[model samples]
Target: MVFNRPKKRAIVESGDGGLGLGIATFIANGEDLGPIIRHSFESGKPEALMQNLRSIVKKKEVEIEELCRLHYEDFIFAVDELCGVLVDAR
Candidate 1:
């Protein structure tokens, strides 16, 4: 049997390694996130939209190792919960 190379799962699995601006730029310029942000702004939820955007990039002085090891599904849940906090803050 032949072995295969490791797939580049980190980007797809970790919000593009958290340097997700390229993903954001692509989405903003392409068909996904950019459109969502546009719609959120048009819907008079600009503050909420900005809050969600901030939630995506929010960093702490110290990141918990548990968070650092989270898989994609878990990470999404964590971020969604975080967005909830930011939305509530508004």
Candidate 2:
């Protein structure tokens, strides 16, 4: 689905990975997320994007919670490892 952003004049897409997971994966892979998020808001789809993000978070909550139990550095490292997988996939 395409989310129209009138302000930024961009049409952000919720990609093929179901809902908006594709976009999230893209961002997690080191792509710049700020522009996409800003455009989503500018285009008036903040709630939609947020919902998708929340879903993604929920799916990862258990994993993230476990990571949090470790040291902060470990959590950061785990995140980096996850994102790195995406980058490698690309």
Task: Tell me the TM-score of each prediction against the true structure.
Answer: 0.32, 0.45
Top candidate on lDDT is: 2
The superposed Cα distance between candidate 2 and the true structure at residue 38, in angstroms, equals 1.5
lDDT of 1 at 82: 100
Instruction: Please report, as a residue range, the 10-residue window in candidate 1 with the lowest summed lDDT.
Output: 10-19
Per-residue lDDT of model 1, residues 1-90, tens digit only:
999864333222223223234334443344356555565557666666566457545533134544666566888899999999999999
lDDT of each: 0.53, 0.68
Report the lDDT tens digits of candidate 2 across residue range 1-90: 998653322334555323365555654555566766786777787887788778777868977877768778977898999999999999
Model 1 spans > 4 angstroms off: 1-31, 59-90
Residue 51 of model 2, lDDT score: 81
